[model samples]
Target: MDISLVAGLLALGAAVGFAAGMLGIGGGMLLVPFMTMLFTAKHFPQEHIVHMAIATSLATIMFTSISSVRAHHARRAVLWRVVKLLAPGILIGSWVGPWIGAQLNSSTLALAFAVFVAFSGTQMLLDKKPAAARELPPAPGMFAAGGVIGVLAGLVGAGGGFVSVPFMTWCNVKIHNAVATSAALGFPIALAGTLSNIYFGMKVPDLPASSLGFIYLPALLVISLASVSTAPLGARTAHSLPVKTLKKVFALLLYSLASYMLYKAFG
Candidate 1:
């Protein structure tokens, strides 16, 4: 691997890990589009670029989420009951989502990613509290909600925090608990999605060297190295900062990313 690529991956990992810790996001949303650009610059096959990006992003999440979640769990913020309720459906939905995504062309997938990210950014920026802060719904409703979060996470290479954290908070869970629980949820989402992408992309053409299915080993290695060390720092920072301010900044960043992805997709 080139030194430049190594540097890029390290930088990306540092940024993503910090975001994951601070925002309770799995960081795949940032990882995906950025990796797409890197892969494109490397002259990876256009058809497989986005798929590789998504797969690699998910793979990285598996590690980063663990680090972030451990830090959050140390703070006693994770809601174990909620994580248990979400796991089954998150796994199923994440597994299925990649199969569906693999059927679409890269440009279409990019467009879809842009749309969802833009929407998520808008939601975070608005930061509207629900009319009523109520308890979580019944088992079935919670499970179904997990399914939705998983599907979107798989499709967009997120950790499901963008959806799940907000959902839990709206259900009257404390924001810290919601963020911590979302970090816990990222494990299943990343695992299921990563495995699905590996299987789905096995027959894909022209994947770059050092690639296992869609996960690029060099990038994964460097990124994981940087991210794992930084994640706990971010989790520590999260507890110290005003999350409202963090969310606003993160929301603006997401909007910028969404716009750039759209430009890349159409330009």
Candidate 2:
């Protein structure tokens, strides 16, 4: 137990957690990279390194999402109705995502992650508005949308906000509502993904000590504790910023994640 290493993880968690709340995301976009670097430095096997990173990131998001949602809920921004409608499909899709992701090689997964993240970044940067008259889809439609969100989010190790926020806003849901609802959705996404990762990793050889399937306990403890605490701070900050500024920040953040994934994939 190196104090310095723990401190580093805590600091990293603080940064990612703040962004997760502020941007209506689960922080996997950032967490995955940070965890990957940590695992690499610890000399974990390359074959399973990315997988473990993603799994641990998802587990941490389980806590961060709740922290963020609590803050949003306080402000009366969360649309529980919408969250209910989207959750079923997200659950189902999230379960399937890790099964497939576990089968992919690190390079393939990294490339795919890059592509999806880049797409999310482009959408954030564009911030296109739907017709003012548009309305949210019916239940079936919302379910279908949730499935897409779940699969993409699971595959990319994301919380699904990059997709959900735009989809909700396009349906004429208020931006704040879209973000809060998306934060709520992160719970399901993280739950399903984390379970699947654990299942997938249970029998695998050479996992680091204190691992629960793909989740690393030491990293999980340090990162999650810091992230959960900071998430509220980010949620509070989210409300104070201008919408345009938020979108731009999200866009830039997504792009940076995408670029890092791409480099890891092909460089």
Query: What's each prediction's TM-score?
Result: 0.96, 0.96
Residue 252 CA error for candidate 2 (Å)? 0.3
Residue pairs with clashing backbones, model 2: none
Q: Give the least accurate 10-residue stretch of model 1, judged by summed lDDT.
A: 126-135
Off by over 4 Å in 2: none
Candidate 1 lDDT, 58-99, residue by residue in tens? 889999999999999999999999999989889999998888
**Residue 233 error for model 1, in Å?**
0.7
Evaluate all candidate structures by whole-model CA lDDT and list the values in order. 0.87, 0.86
Residue 195 lDDT in candidate 2: 89
Candidate 2 per-residue C-alpha lDDT over 135-221 given as tens digits, one digit per residue, 9 for 90 to 100:
888899989988989888877678989899878877878777777788899999999988888888897888878999878889888
lDDT of 1: 0.87
Clash totals in order: 0, 0
lDDT of 2 at 75: 99
